[model samples]
Target: MKSYSVKELLEKQPVGDVVVINGWVKTFRSNRFIALNDGSTIHNLQCVVDFEQFDDALLKQISTGAALKISGTLVESQGKGQLVEIQTTDIFVHGKADPDTYPIQPKKHSLEFLREKAHLRIRTNTFAAVMRVRSALAFAIHSYFQQNGFYYMHAPIITGSDAEGAGEMFRVSTLNPKNPPLTENGEVDYEHDFFGKETNLTVSGQLEAETYAMGLGKVYTFGPTFRAENSNTSRHLAEFWMIEPEMAFYDLDANMDLAEDFIKWILKYVLDNCNDDLQFLESRLLDEEKSKPQHERSEMPLIEKLKFVVENNFKRVSYTEAIDILKNSKPNKKKKFQFPINEWGADLQSEHERFLVEKHFNCPVILFDYPANIKAFYMRLNEDDKTVRAMDVLFPGIGEIVGGSQREERLDVLQQKIKALDIDEKELWWYLDLRRFGTAVHSGFGLGFERVVQFATGMGNIRDVIPYPRTPQNAEF
Candidate 1:
């Protein structure tokens, strides 16, 4: 008489109780067994029915992908696969899916094929487990920040200032594109736009989160961020979620400490809470790697890889030292790197970061004190003036997992850096005011939510982890 989720029923194992369960039919076999799932858990509920008791017409309605509600008495399963199953006494068909037309069939479907059917892909075991783990990780992120005395802040999605200064942004305007207002010099005038000036989607919330951290002491933002870069790679996405935490009175070293500890805590939470989903994903990864050569496969199991990170201390190396190691390493010297690490100022690519984590150190590594020219304008300038107090946490196979820095707090020094980059001081006047009024040593880092999900789930493509991935020339779902 009471409806129960498969997860709850499985955990409680209310044997001999009459229970009502609502779910979509995964499979109907031999006119008796029905595999049903409600998207609450990865495991399906085995529903056994007596063929002679029900009309053939009613039994015909129970097909794969059909939504159904069934009331039955739960009993210990005589079958070996699962512990309990339902003895169906009554049935109701809420909806039916044509087996021929349903995109999500019982057979194996490619990840590429599933992406096209993004709306219904969650019905699959892989995506359902992935999304469940992703949901748990999101909760873990907020939990860590809240327990450590940090306030959650919401940064604006649309803004006039460019945080990254790369200038690749999706414009936000209500003006007519075909024929809009013009300036005196004949350029498109943004003065009369919706916000009365040019605005675009935010790339990072660090700048705005810094303002909140100045007053709040510790604050974090978990929200959507956009980038208009035209990258169609498996590792890139046009839109993604970022988890950024800003802390007042923290230096770059402290920032690195927080990043390492935060990542470990959230990962451990997933290991404990989402064991069923994680076990499924781990087995999936092992099967996926079977086609590849032995050298290409991961040495450790998926869960072990996560545990390795949580158990080990992240190796800390300066940018100069990392450069030295890469320069002398077999890959760089033998031209194995795709983007070769030539000099200290060269930005480290995914290959280089992977080398440091997977091959060189065999653990997570934190590289710091990047060259000023390669980093953004906001990082604190070191005493030598050549490098900024910036850091990036490199993970096994994932490369850069987190990036942050000790922000430039000295008003004069920050102004000099801003002028060197030729950024509009007027646009960032409010940001500069933080330093003018009550600036202290502050630091923060951003971890791409998708990247973390990819690593945790052992998902190969960045697109597979997100619900609806936005990529170059692709927004279908």
Candidate 2:
């Protein structure tokens, strides 16, 4: 007899063969049936045991959350819903969980309650399925990039330059916090710090990946990025993973095409490969929305929503046009929008972005050519001198799923932008070198990895999809 994982045993279904398996018991019903799970699949393998044969101590150890090893013969299950069962002949208790002390029970628990038990939440069906899908999505992302002739680049985590220019980054230093060196101006002297100058965790890897793209022709980075934004919303996180891809000689149009195709491809992969987990998630979402009013419920099931994106073409509209639509739209005219859209050059919020995708367009929308003042300084300035070649991909549920642009390749224009923004040129001296020596047109985009996982899993809160979510003032695990 050989040990087999629950997933493998369930798939192979070798009836009449004796097998050995180790797993944590999910439930012990009537002292006869044991529901065994090994984090291999959402389903549990039912093991039938005759209580008369096992010792009283061993029988008591088969309670939920206890680890056990069993040797049994596989047979066709007399029970419904399951295909096969284990007829146990021997039992070994590896560990025991006191029923009164175990935090997880075989019952429905709220997401909020499970969040506090982050370390043991994976034993639940919901988190287990979400994590499995997250893993599949990660592998699919790499597969798509590799098959499309893109090199994976590893960007540095700590840097002296601000990539997003948002000035929201976690500081990385070894200096004493209570008393630190001060400069002549009475400011904290970063010169005496570990790096000799101020350094922080990178908020984005786009700037570094661009350097690689210029040399490698095409490159992508999938790594953890940090931000110090003090937002306590369900969508915000202090630390998250980012997927950024940069390509040389690609204009804004080419960038939009790549993003659209990439999103559709990866989503379709999940839809095809993760049917079981997705079905479970879809059912879970449907049950969750039942309490809400009819209007608040999703228009379609989770799987259908994903298929909608993969099947349909994203409607491409300009920022100017989107503003015009929002200005005259029913929401703005009726004073329903919280942040009303009035004119151009106004930054669009999540409400506006969601409106463009869900209400106005009824599909995924790609809004491009944003006003130069609202976008980052690195975007290519349009001929009108008022807008930049920046674009955002908006989905039905989430506002901005992806953001990218054709970078400003003109050395003079980039320098002027940097100067006007009051950024220290010394920090980005190496970045400017690429332009001075051999600059070519390049474009890239940053996609929030957790956001995608949340959308795919139909998980309402962004924190639930990630394993160990790091948020504002909440690092319990």
* Top lDDT prediction, candidate number: 1
lDDT of 1 by residue, 1-477 (tens): 579999999999999999999999999999999999999999999999999999998888878999999999999999989999999999999998988788898999999999999999999999999999999999999999999999999999999999999999999999999999999999889999989999999999999999999999999999999999999998889899999999999999899999999999999999999999999999999999999999789867899999999999999999999999999999989998889887779999988998888888999999999999999999999999999999999998788989999999999999999999999999999999999998899999999999999999999999999999999989996
lDDT of 2 by residue, 267-292 (tens): 99999999989999999999999999
Q: What is the C-alpha lDDT of each candidate?
A: 0.94, 0.94
Model 1 scores a TM of 0.99
By how many angstroms RMSD does model 1 differ from the true structure? 0.9
lDDT of 1 at 284: 92
- Per-candidate TM-scores read 0.99, 0.98
Candidate 1: 10-residue stretch with minimal lDDT: 336-345
Model 1: lDDT of residue 462 = 98
